[model samples]
Target: MPDRWDCVRENTEWVCKSTVVANTKEAIIILTAKEIGPEDSLAAYESHLKTPRMVPDAQGRPQKSVIKSVVSRKIAQHTWLDGLQLGSEIPSYYTRYLATVKSRLAILVTFSAHQRYFTKYSGDFFKAVNSLRIVANSDLLNPSATSSLELGGSEQIGPGQVPGFGSPLQVPDLDTLPSEPSGAPRNQQLLFLIGIIIAVAGIFIFLKRK
Candidate 1:
């Protein structure tokens, strides 16, 4: 997680928001993990891309989800969609669904925001996604296993760790995923905050000298 994001645990879900853009409630990211069985498959989720189900928009009008694209890599699948269409008076709602499996563990991450404000905070969202890592420790592969994250980046579970239970489920076989987005900014808000504090201190020092 980015240092500038506020994250909280709600049962099995981790809800996160960019501190700088916290005012926009739609600027959020949610992550959940669970053990899967042989019956669960990525194909089941892909079916929705072919045939979308209607969902209510902000105005309470029914609209079908718009499929943007699908990206797949070894043990991972990505789906981008516009959940709500852009209207004359309402902004379009966008969401990215990312599912990854390793052994018996399946992880799902959802990133969402209104189209009007997505670009402003997209860097943080993508960074969070790219940072995810799967731990191979044996202790984490059981039903009673638990994990926690620290605030700083040095901790093993702080930034890129995924939380979940273990299973004997089977996952889809796929080729290697493409490289992550290299251009995304990291800890941007933290740097910006530091700059502001320095400027304020400089001004205060000048006034004190006067």
Candidate 2:
């Protein structure tokens, strides 16, 4: 008769073996089986229990006996490698996963951090992380970077460039433009006043005549 056994770890199934003693470790597993030769014998009482009568071979052993086995295991013990801790200081790969939630969720969680880091770095943090999502299989870290808005361009005036908005561009004021010299403009001013008086007198005369 052949013996069968199974190995399991955590919630995952590991391997199945026959006639082997198996040992599992954090990073590796070992399996061993003894190949009983035909001449290997059990106690006489133990052999008597078998359906067929068994005789010891020339070496005074069992007539036939053999064992075969196999071993299989995972390459890594834990999902994370490099001995890094989880939570606040999680790995980059894991962070990318977190970003893949809805855009609102991403903003709720990553917006402040993104602003703080990118303000100093001057590069699009979400864009870089989104690019990483193309390779990282985890969807939890893939985030949309579309909410960012562009302020303005060269031709269009920016808020900072507008008047009273800290713009260095100097705009000439209408009230500051030069006026004709006051002394030399006296005759012209008198003529302008006389013309207004004559026009008013003509209007009164025309109304009386009507």
Candidate 3:
């Protein structure tokens, strides 16, 4: 995974965006680790999971929306990961959040176009995330498990150093996928080339006649 440097990126957010190419479809996942206060995640998640309550619009009429349940698990000693399945309108995709124990770090991971790809690659996805580590120990972040990044140059970059972390999961096997264009850019280019060739031929004939 490569870290993207842009205006939106900030010191608190360690965001890495990856494009996954599969046999049938293309998808993207954005991994974010943001610094937060100790134990801030639970409160935030509870607030988001609040029951469906109606608030009035300008017309004083009430507007309502469905509220979904939140699911969670302990990823490490104190570290945790939470997931909330979305509404029927957006089935097949869920929102997820993670907090590292004692490190005051929060992680956000989302899978897009999930309905189209999850069934085929769920195994690989889970297996890959297991490689995620959240400890500060350099020894555990061994060279064998580390991967090289192209953020600046060719130097290798390991996972962020938190307090305690390790996993049986490995880096995802991201299959290379060719992106598709909305239209045939190749055909358009071919037509442009033919037009130029015809123009050149006409010019050559005109000059010869002259």
Candidate 2 lDDT for residue 120 = 24
The collision pairs in model 3 are 131-169
State TM-scores per candidate. 0.57, 0.12, 0.40
Q: Could you give candidate 1's per-residue lDDT for residues 1-210 as a string of tens digits?
A: 677777666554566676765264546666654544443356644443345445544456666555555555432133322122121112244556665544444455566655555565667766765554444333334433323221111221121222221111122322222122456544444333323333333343345545
Estimate candidate 1's alpha-carbon lDDT, on a 0 to 1 scale.
Answer: 0.44
Q: lDDT tens digits, residues 1-210, model 3? A: 222211122232222323333222222333443233333456554454443334333344554423444455654344444443322112223223332322333344433323344444443334333434443322211112112111111121111111011221122433332132232111122223223333333343345545
In candidate 1, what residue range of length 10 has the lowest lDDT sum?
A: 150-159
Against the hidden true structure, what lDDT does model 2 obtain?
0.19
- Model 2 root-mean-square deviation: 45.6
Candidates' C-alpha lDDT: 0.44, 0.19, 0.32
